[model samples]
Target: MNVRVMNAAVAKTVAPDKPAAAAPAHIAATGLAVDFPLEGRKQRVLNDINIAVPKGSFVSLIGPSGCGKSTLLKVMAGLVTPSEGTMTVAGLSPQEAVNARLIGLVFQEATLLPWKNAIENAAFLLMTADETIKKSEAFDRAAAMLKLVGLDGAEKKSPSQLSGGMRQRVAIARALALDPEVLLMDEPFGALDAITREEMSECLLDIWERTNKTIVLVTHSIDEAVFLSREVHVMGTGPARIIETLPITVPHPRTEESYSDPAFTAAENRLRSLLIESHKKGRR
Candidate 1:
């Protein structure tokens, strides 16, 4: 399918800046490491990690289960602090970027409020974060976001009324309502069945193309990483670190048929090989 152009109405609502050829790094980390206390001893979860995600690009991190992918994402979100080196989002420290509302985060579960309807839940963060925003205006902005996420007519539906995929769409709408410059997702579609997972992948690509938001996704599925990312950062465990950065040369507006494209298959195979090799090394 051809990439859908952002309509003027949604364009005005988002007001996204088109990414320049020389777009600066939206998120960067250098020699980043994280440690946690285990049995009164410092356990290193990540080591010597460096990454640079250009503005408006889609990137994915894939690795073995215990390879610290989520932890690296948390460090970028400012939910966790790095024990060493530096991290930045939009040239500011992660915490500062978070304080400025430049970051939006979505996790494995939708985590919507049971009591609130779709629009209410989408507007919740904006209303709470900025006391100056009137509830009506927040709802209006949230309605637009819901529409952007393909949830226009379902605004009145409560979380319980939505399916797993629809609930995740609501969760994404909630994050987008902030109009954040960057979106960090840690396994956002991990809970869904295979077919829904594929559907969500397409939904996400459409959203990314329209919003031009710099996105970093942590996923376990190699096919997903191949299909969605401009570049896949393959990580290794045993003091988890990025071992390879594989660029996906597939042209954008990728469709379901892209799955069978030679480039897609090659990238998937390469990623699978890397993960298998890493697992073997970890066993040694």
Candidate 2:
């Protein structure tokens, strides 16, 4: 979209009121460092990492395993405290944002309740003490989100009864039930088969368009990252740092044919080269 080129028009109308606030930055992380105790010694996972996610933007965090991809995400989610640095969801602490029901996380696993139906599972977030999803209105909201993800008819089913991909769709619906300003996805399609993974990625893109929620997705696949994100954040291992922040350039509602587009292929190849370089440097 050449967001910079569209400045005047967007700055005046399009960008603002597109997502949560009037052109407010969705998420911003700066100088983020994560270290944990390991074998009686301190082990640094991420270091000197900085990234900013603009409102209504889709960003993919790609890195080798143990390179602190998930750790950085957790730091943004407020689940793990960073050793140093800062993170914000809509310019607020992740914890405070989460308390205000502004941050939504879609785990790698479904994490749905086996005993509850899709509607019930989505409503469960409302029972939370610190934050609420508004169970009364959550069911309809969840169903609409399901429809957005192309699972309109599956809302009556339970997690145990649904397929892996369908379950993940329900999980996505649950995440959207609260109308979150930012969606944090941790390789939600990593568990699915190849074909299913591609389908789920398309589904996610559809949902992203309908609601315009800012998304930060983590994945190990270059193709997946390139296909789904407007920008890709590639990281290196050993006190993980961002090796690259390549822009996707492709617009939203990407088609299956776009997968074969020259631009898409080029972006995928570039990210692949970066990943290989990371490996050559003794990184995962």
Cα-based lDDT for every prediction: 0.88, 0.79
> What is the TM-score of each predicted model, taking all chains together?
0.91, 0.88
Candidate 1 deviant stretches above 4 angstroms: 1-23
In candidate 2, what are the lDDT values of residues 1-284, reduced to their tens digit?
A: 23224333322222211232234567877777888999999999888877878888898999878778998889888899878888888888989987888888998899998899877786666556334445556677767777877777777888888899988888888788768888999999999999999999888887888888999999988888988898788887865787667778665569898888887888887778768877777533
Mark the regions of model 2 whose C-alpha exceeds 4 Å error after superposition: 1-24, 129-135
Residue 28, candidate 2: Cα error in Å is 1.3
RMSD to truth, every model: 9.4, 6.7
RMSD of 2: 6.7
Q: Pick the lDDT winner.
A: 1
- Model 1 lDDT, full chain set: 0.88
Task: Write the residue-wise lDDT of candidate 1 on 130-235 in tens digits.
Answer: 8899999999999999998889999999999999999999999999999999999999999999999999999999999999999999999998999999988888
Q: Give the local distance difference test score of model 2.
A: 0.79
